[model samples]
Target chain A: MAREKRRWVAYGLTVPSYLWLAVTVFLPLIVMLYFSFLSKMPFGTAEPVLTLKHYKSFLDRDFYHFLTWRSVKLGFHVTFFCLIIGFPAAYILARKVHGRWREAILLLIVLPFWSNTLIRIFAWTMVLRTNGLVDQMVHAIIPGAPSVGILYSYPAIVIGLVHSFIPYMILTCYISLQAIEDSMIEAGRVLGASSLSIFWRIILPLSLPGVVVGVVLIFVPVVGAFMEPRILGGRQSIMLGTVIEDQFTEVFNWPLGAALSFILLAIVMAIFAACYPLLRNRMKLT
Target chain B: MTRWIAYGRRIVGMMAGLAMLGATSVAVADEVRVLNWKGWGTDEAWAVAEFEKQTGTKVVHDYITSFPETFTKLRTNPGYYDIVVLNAAFVEKAAREGLIQAVDPAMVANSADLYPDMRDTPQLNFDGKVWGIAWVWGGTSVTYDTEVFKTPPTSLDVLWDPAHADRVCWRDNAEDSVRFAALALGQNPDQPEDLDAIREKLRALKPQVKAFWKSGDEWLKLVAAKECDLSIVWTNNTEAAAVQDNLPVSFIVAKQGAVAFRDGLAMPTNPPNAKGAYAFMNYLISKEFYAGWVKIGGAPVSANSKAVEELPDSSLTRQVLTQPDAIKRLNFKGPLSDEERQTYLDLWQETKAYFAE
Candidate 1:
């Protein structure tokens, strides 16, 4: 009886998280899957009749494929940009900076994230707007150069997403870089290796794990990002997120929305699966 | 043990007495809780005072910020409100879903007091039965910074000009934005069922737009920053932002015209205070009340055309989204079958993709 009661208590303890996931994640996925195979009702309601009309609709259009490719491209650009800038910053902070200054600098790098996400995006908008700070500075510097405001462009959208997610990449790399013993680099240096060779041979190989984690964390969401592109990007920068959102909210085609979401999910899963074997090899080789 | 049992029986009797008292209060129909659009609810304190003076019923008001939230809340908790304000697009859906109750004209005597045009507007009646009462109507148009442009462009064609490319803003809302672009492209999205050509035109104009604003706060911020010189915006949001923030913005009736909209008041399927709701609706439609509301930027249904004339021109009216005459040239957002609407939305997504490319 005591064992049974303890079991019940353990189950009860996990109920909240399970319920939350069921409501927000699992249930929605199930509903979306069911709808993806259905026909659209005349009043924008999902019909009870089962059909693959929405799936076929998505397949028939070349636009979805184009959007998916664009999103993947944007995601790669963000991941690559973050890796280039973030890895070096993390190395300097983790290896070079000492004692209190290191902690303070790291804190400074992450301090801006405490503010609300939406407010941060709005701040970016202000900085990028015409006659705003960036444009004003440009005019002052060039005198007669046409003002190039960053607002409503793909560059602006990418910048906002990068600025918001860069800290994740930095922190991940910092931990990985910190985990490597100082002796490993020193040993490489003592073996007639130059400073650059020591880093390339030892530090670069060790940091792959953090790089994988950071890449997945940023890449998955960036591909699905809607608000950043919608608010900052002009007509020339629609992402997959916008397409999925239209299926649910304005179009009332929940089924199509669900299908689009699954398509994205499938793509994300496929990438992760394909990367696993390669990542394992890197882990073992390093 | 006998004494303890006697005490328990007395406690049960007392609990039953309290339950009876609670039931009596419910039967009295004392308080009416209302759920509605942000600005359209009865002046809660004022309505409470007036209802108390006349019918001895109290009023409770709950305001929802957005239309989707309101619909979701109503469908989820139907009994939470005695009445709600829904737009034409939603009224049919709400009625068909049986989320709202049919309003009996006899209960709401002031139903006759509403202007005939408003009385018969598709917003209030879904298939001949009264579903809601038309309260306000307005149109969408381009709001621009007059100070920047010497002569603020009157035509939607200005939006397509290469010179103005990347200088224009549009509503982020898909339904309105799609129609606005279609009309700007010289296609009557409201009238024609054939939207393929309209879709292509909107897709072509995508490169010219700078940003899609999602909120009034963002619109104000965009204009203040000079990030955008021109925007396709609603009259209420533009007027409120301009008047409140003292922004250098003015709205105009785009030459191609834009979609007009209306929102109305309706009762839910089962109301807690049905009689009191009827009493409040009656008081809301009085000419004195209606005129006072419109003067303060509330677009009351002008049942008596003289009521509109009675409204003093605020400096803002000179720059409303569209004049009544301009409204005539535009397409009315009447009934759209589900398939027809989805096609438009699909085209909107397609057009968005074209611009994105």
Candidate 2:
């Protein structure tokens, strides 16, 4: 009787959280799924019939294909840039720097988060535009060097996304790097392995789990990021995410928007599934 | 266990007290809920304050970043709005959906002096009812750097000029792009005969574009930083840049013409506070309100003909809006059916994608 009562209490404790999740997350997704299959919005006097046309829009059109590729390319570019910029800084702090210095450097790395993302993205426009701070500085140094008018282009979008998301990579990799024992590196060095080989064989593989997590965290949102691309990418701003946004906000085509969202969710899930085995071997996910 | 139960009871009591506090505040004030773009004329802090003081009714506002978002909000939540501020092109659609109700123009005391061109438009009147009070109107056209162009550029083709390549900016809106491209091609901007030609023209012009600006402030920033020598921008933004901010930009209606627009106030259907809604609408269209908003130049030009008289001739609002030639050349874009808008949106997006390639 006591065991059954304890079990009941445990379930009672979990039921509220499950209920909250159902209300907050699963319910809206189910509603979105239903909306995705509708012919028209069933608000007011208009009658809508069930249909596959919304999904068919994805299948029939080449526009969605091009936009999807654009978004994926953006994700890759941002992830790659974040890795290159973040890994070196994270490593030097994690392995070389000690005591309060590491803490101060880490604090500076994440300091940009105190300001809003939109403000940071807007700040880049001042730096990247023609005759902007970048151009003025370049001209002063080089004496009539051509202006560095890089804003409102793909490169500008990449720079903005990297600035916004690189913190994730640094922090995640820092945590993983800190967990490594100093003895492991010392052992490798005693075996007469060069510094490059010790890092390549010992340090990189062990710390990769954090890098993977950071890549997943950064890649998912970067692909669906509308504001950075819209604010910085200019005429090249139309991506899969922006198109989906326009469908809901500008076109009032909820069915199409929901359908597009489902497609994005599916794509992200497939990527995770492909990466799951590798993650399982490295991290505790198994 | 007994002490834990007492703690739980105290927490519950505190929550209940907080809820009551919220409820009593709502009960004490009569509120007229308005839905509009944030900080636009209707929701300006000073205007809201004045209205609240005079009428003893508190004003609350909800904002929308886009027009379709406005329609979605109205549809999903009925009886939640007293007033909806919409572009005139959307008024007819809003009425047909019964999201908003029509009022006789005679009801508004200041309606007598409203400009016939902006006020008595088919877009704001349909099914034999005046659905919205035309509040402010402006032009969306070419704005160029005076420092770069010694003489005013006359044609829309100036956007595609190689000289301004990497120095041209355009609005990042599909409808605006479609309408502007149509006008440039000498096709009816309201209903273009050929969209493929417009698509090709836009794709070709993409090489010259420095940016596709999303907001008026961004356009000013771009122009101020000398990133854009030529741009398609709203009239009021250009006025502020040149007249107020000492930028070298000049607002001009190209020989082909410019896109004209009106934003107005309307009564949403089944408003909880009908009397308060009417009082607020009257104040919005009042001469004093328009004149005050125009002086700031943060808002669009007044749609009231009488209000324009209140501004000095030196005021850019008076000078830019009072020109007969500019008025004559204005090509006000009309409302589009869902299918038509979708077609234009698709073409616009496809052209943008081609540009990316």
Candidate 3:
């Protein structure tokens, strides 16, 4: 009787969470799948026409293939740049800095979060555009220099995305780094290990879980990123995400958008499946 | 265990009370809510306040970010909205979907004063009933920096000119991109005689394009930075930039004419406050309201001819529109069917891919 009561309690506690997930996540995904098979948008009393043409068109088009590659490449580039920049900052904050100063500096790191993301993107335009902030600063430093107009390019997209997503890498890595015992590093030093060797052999391996999590969080959204690419990349901004968005927003073809979204989801799942083993082991530490 | 049961019951009671509060507010009959682009027509605070003064009903608004979103909001949340602002192209689709109902002419006397061409379009008339009430309209055309070109290019051919090609900005929308390219190729925008010509023309022009802008904010940013020499822009945005922003730009309707679009007001199906909605819609399209809207600045040309006529000669809307010249040159955007739009969008995506290549 007691065991049954405990089981009922468990179900009562978990039921709300499961219900929330069904409503927010699974239900919408199922609806999208249904919409993907529709031949056209059914209106008024008209019967819905279902077909497999939306999927067929994806298979047939070289445009979708090229855009998919571009979006994935973009994800890789942003993830890589964030790691190279954020890992060091997080390491210093965790190891080198201490107490009040560390807290203040950590607060400084999160300062940009106060402003909205769209505003931050627009702000970057003012800095990167011709004869704008960057140009003004450079021209002040060196007289008669040509402007470094980097706005509306592939590099600008990378820069904007990295700035937007780097905080994830920093905060996640900081959590892992803070958990590492000082005694472990002391033992490594006592065993006559150099700083670089200690880092490669122990510190990086210890922080692997946080780094992987951060990579996933940043990479997934960056792959589906449309606004940053369109704002910063301009004419060169076309990607799988932009194409999918255009289908719904511009072309008014919900079926094509749904099909493209499912294809993207499948590709992301395949990538995660390949990495699952390594991720499982590393994630256990946290 | 007994204490926890009491706690659970109290939480449930609180939630039920909150739900009841939401229901009561929504059930208010005197409130007429409209959905439209922010600060456009019906949402104009002054106009809405004036309506509220005469009619006891409260006028409220919710803003839509895109055309598809307007449909989603109305269909998903029935009785939430009473009116929606639709572009000329969307009236038929809205009516066909039963998302909106036909507005009787008796409901709006001001609608009679709307330009005959706008009131009598096939897009508005179907099954002997008008789907949308004509509101305001303007053209999509080229705006050039006076600083860059001493002599303003008089024709659409200026877009393809090699000397000025490196600084041209095009809108990123597929339908508009296809339509403009068709116009540049001397083909009908609605049903282009040659689809292949549009594809080739877009590919050839891709090299010259400095950037593509999606929003007015981005277009203005590009202009301020001198990143573009010529850009495809809406007439209202051009007037604002030249007059308000003090940008040295010239708005010109090319010899081929501008791509004209009209904004209209439509009634959503089974509104919570249909009587209040009609009164609000009637007040929005009146000549007095339009005259006030023009004074407010950033107003599009009025659909009612008399409303436009009332504006002073110094009004920027009057000077830029030049009704005598503009009326003749206005090239209405085709009410292209869904299948045709899909085809145009497909070709446009292909052209963009080619641009990337």
lDDT of 3 by residue, B222-323 (tens): 888788889988878877787678898877878777788888888888887888888887888888888787766667887787887766776555775666
lDDT: worst 10-residue window of model 3 chain B: B1-10
lDDT of 3 by residue, A1-286 (tens): 9999999999999999999999889976876787787775543243456689999999899988988889989999999999999999999999999999999988988988888999999889888887879989999999899978788788989999999999999999999998999999999999999999889778988998789889999999999998888888866888889888889887668789999999998898788898898778765653
Q: What is the DockQ of each candidate?
A: 0.23, 0.36, 0.29
In candidate 2, residue B3 scores what lDDT? Answer: 48
Q: Taking the tens digit of each residue's C-alpha lDDT, what string does model 1 give over B1-357?
A: 334334433443444355445533444447776787555536644545766788777766666655555665565455657878776667887888788988887776666666688778766776869898766566677778878788877788887788878778877665676677667666666666546666666766666777777666777777776767788876666666666667777777766786777667788888877877887777665565555555555243344343455555664553353356776765657656557667767777777777776
Residues A1-286, model 2: lDDT tens digits = 9999999999999999999999889966876787787776655555667789988889888988888888988999999999999999889989999999999999999899999999999899888877778888999999978768788789999999999999999999999998899999999999999999988888888898889989999999998888898888877777888888888877788888899989988887787899889777765521
Docking quality (DockQ) of candidate 2 = 0.36
Considering just the first chain, candidate 2 attains a TM-score of 0.90
The predicted structure with the larger DockQ, 2 or 3, is: 2
When sorted by TM-score, best at the front, the candidate numbers are 2, 3, 1
What is the Cα-based lDDT of residue B325 in candidate 2? 84
Q: After superposition, how far is residue A38 of candidate 3 from its true place, in Å?
A: 3.1
- What lDDT score goes with residue A120 in model 1? 86
Q: What TM-score does the predicted chain A of each candidate obtain versus native chain A?
A: 0.87, 0.90, 0.92
